[model samples]
Target: MVKKQNIPAKEKIVSVVLLAGLILFMAIVIGPGFSEPSSPNQNVAEQMLPAGWSAVGGWEIYPKGRLYEKINGREPLFDQYGVVRLRYASVSKGTNDFEVYFYDMQTPDGALGIYLANTPSEFDELELGTLADISGGQVRVLKGRTYLEIFSLAEQTPKDFLIDLSSALVETIPTEKEARRTAVELLPKQGRVRGTLILNRENTYGLAKLTDIFSASYQQDNDEFDYMIRTISPSEGRKMIAAVGEEIFEFDGEIIQSETNSLVAEFMGKTLILNQTGDFLIGLYGAVPPDQGRRRLDQWIETMKDQLHGSGK
Candidate 1:
């Protein structure tokens, strides 16, 4: 025997609606992990193939979690720059092969961050993407929100091929015109050495816990010096000072305490004049004396202030 209860049409509709809502919520919470990563539609392979070259296969996509499978030991560097996804493809021309890697780094700055961290043995600038350079056997580019790399698998890597491929890749990626001006605008430009500016995402100047630092070299009075700037929360700055207090003292040099939380010290022939103002840390490194270093640091701060005030930024 079976017993059945007749449900009202409105009740059935409400029940179905409730179930649909639940499913939607679950999808919102857990769907992304299972779904395919949303990689940019870059139809690059067809253009990359030369007359005799053949693509090995379709593009291979690697999300952050699976990036390690492709890069292995270098995953952390990509992770540091907020890499979204990686689209990779390979092609072979007889015995000559080439690999193209497109890393979606989330933002232009994120792309540049990774680029700055890479200290290449030599730099040959290329006028492709936002910033591009050829180093060793690779051509690296930072354009839009992407960090693209093309590696040469053959002994004879033609510079013309690299240039053409880089130009093509740059055309595919989007760029923000306004973002072209970066924090470099905040820095005083006078006497700055071209091609000497760089960003260190972490552990700047071999100081542990010092991160997101921008530095440049300036030529003054027949001498060159490094000026560094970093924005940090007051609490984090204090914590860094506390964490590195012992290490700072361990330097085999004269330590001159000029002001509270500010020091002019000589370490390994370099004079370091570090000053903390609110949420900003500024330092100048040179062979100058403590008094000269302090005066120079103050002048730089004033110059920065004037620049900002003039720009109304």
Candidate 2:
């Protein structure tokens, strides 16, 4: 048996208030959808400079408009990649000194674009961020919309310290799927060479007219060729085909009309085929035998169409 005692109104109100406070406290401490307070991001470059290092003159910010103040000749390259700004600093730890550069490329794809454009042909690699490249004493990383570089002073290569510093910055940026998704979305699943996708906002294949293109290589049945895809209207596509018909750089090729609006060109022992499918311009290079090149190009174009329509396997 239980006995009930009448409680005073004031005490009852206080008890209810205390109970509500406890519930709120628990929700904040161990609840889903609640995040801990975080340090401000703009200054993260300084806060995450690693344990034993310090920026020589603090971090200097250079907006896109003023980037030329810091890097006169290279600003155009970064501008093409959609860089939003840059954070520059010189860091030193014990006997090692480094020049650090942090770039905000505005989007993950932009970050990846600049990273790939600058990647050296031969270099050691690091698994930091989305990916990192180490050439000599310099290291570059692409993380979400951010790209980081650390250049060794006096040609001194302090590999371990540079990695540690990069790790600290990488942890500050949250992971984003844009860079990863671009490769998967724009390239076919089969024989895509995995990490070979390059989002080119600048001249593609050194063709000034071809910008904002996605390029990758495919290898199947011991045959390899480069494929490119870009958003283009039918009218523009026809114009590009006409331009290629006249001349494709040093490759003097003869353009032959294929299907309705499709065209094929064979020159200098290389075959090039291009067509406009819906709002996309799809093409192939290094594929020989005009018939075989058209076949492979058509197959890849179909795959890309399926991907764009959300029916890709």
lDDT of each: 0.71, 0.72
Pairs that collide, model 1? none
Query: In model 1, which runs have C-alpha deviations exceeding 4 angstroms?
Result: 1-58, 91-97, 106-110, 176-180, 183-209, 216-221, 231-269, 275-280, 290-313
Task: Assess every candidate by TM-score.
Answer: 0.60, 0.61
lDDT per residue for candidate 2 within 1-313, as digits (tens), equals 8999999999999999999999999988876433322223445556767777787767777878777777789999999889998878888888888888889997766787888888777778688876787888888988778888878886667677778877887786667743224442455657877557677675556555556767888888877887877756667766766665555544555665645446677655677777766656678877567788888887766655544432111
Please report the candidate that would top TM-score against the real structure.
2
Report the alpha-carbon TM-score of model 1 versus the true structure: 0.60
Residue-level error in angstroms, candidate 2, position 213: 3.1
